[model samples]
Target: MFHQITVAFMLLIVRALAHDSPGGQVVLTSDETTTQESTLHVVQEELKEAEIIPTVIDDFLPKFILNVEWSSSNYASLGNLLKVKRLQSEPRITLREASDSSASLCASNMTYIVTMTDPDAPSRDNPKWSEMCHFIVTGLTLSSTSEEASSKVHFTDLQAIIPYKPPGPPPKTGKHRYVLLAFAPANGTTDPLHVSKPEDRQHWGTGKEGHGVRDWAKANGLKPVAANFFYAKNKKQ
Candidate 1:
């Protein structure tokens, strides 16, 4: 099944990260409403056995809220309007390559890619069957042979895709905005990495726990920078 494949892929990626030369840390957390104590405990034990530190954020906290705020005037009852929601919340992408820093992705270095996805969508408020996004972050520096080539990307991998629906009597024309973010060490930075292929976004939101680029960066002592608005287009292959 698709779910199994996604979970397997996520596990493989995490395992790879644990074995990385400079071995990085991974933290998995759940929203307050969900009791993730047992799950977190298991993950911690596993990480410890593997010599990786794991952190969890289960207490209901404002900093962990993941929703968009619309204008007060435009905000109607939750049941009435089509609102934006996160399909994949917190998928982490790990890149491994032979570079000393983040500046060498373009220098003929091959990077390993890891990503996650969230498929949950809003209810009947909108007529669309599903609305989701994919995010990918690579870990090229971790795998690089050059000590100077091991810098992380300054941003997270982000891609949004919405299915098309027939307009009723009046065809409405408007735009929806999605955000792509990146996080890196304070002194570390890089120009925006451009994704020109649809396949790049397809690997997102496929993990047991949703992945967020910001969370991944923070766990790894990095800062996050987000791109405010991204427009999705309809293209035929």
Candidate 2:
């Protein structure tokens, strides 16, 4: 009876060992499984971060200012001129010279304006519309003859027009283009126009009185000699 009991006990031990193994290999401990899961999660997070794209400032600059122009489409008249306002994302207008000058410096008190127009915008009768352009300008001064200053105004402080009402919705199935133009006086600081009201001037992102760059440029003597273009893509098919 004692020998029989010993054999049964040995068989039980072998069964338990086999159960703890998988595919003839020893099973991993709980801690080891947890560590492997954590490592995989970390690797996934790193891959996601690597896929993100970074936005660069120089990418926005136009290759040639001469390529800028106004749209010849009816969408220009869709919104009331008095009620038209600039987009929130694009707040400032700036101007830069084609060639650099040693004496020239970007300075504060510089003013700019931006305009968006879609010439190929589809009409009510036409279904297909061509792409449009967006513009931005920097490096404007008060007058043509004013001495160059080191501190220059950025697009943030540039003058713009913001209306009481929001801009009309974009057309269906068509991409809208806006042209941003930055202008400076050929001479310097002859007449400075205040584009914002006292209350409206304080807010940066809001559509305050001085919020539209295009409106501010029009109020001032700045001309649209140079410009950049951007096209808004269509999300729907």
lDDT of 1 by residue, 1-237 (tens): 874465445545544543552213232323343233322333333433322121111211111111121332211111122223312233222232212223432334332322222212222123132223444444323323233233323333323222212111112323222332223344343433333222222222223233333344444444332111222222211
TM-score, candidate number 1: 0.22
List ranges where model 2 is wrong by over 4 Å: 1-88, 91-94, 100-110, 120-156, 163-171, 185-190, 194-221
Full-model lDDT, candidate 2: 0.32
**Candidate 2: tens digits of C-alpha lDDT, residues 75-176:** 121111211233323332223333233123234564444444333334222413311223333334433222223333444454344421122325463443
Candidate 1: list runs displaced more than 4 Å: 1-133, 139-175, 187-211, 226-228, 233-237
Q: What is the TM-score of each candidate against the true structure?
A: 0.22, 0.33
lDDT of each: 0.29, 0.32
Q: CA lDDT of 186 in candidate 1?
A: 43
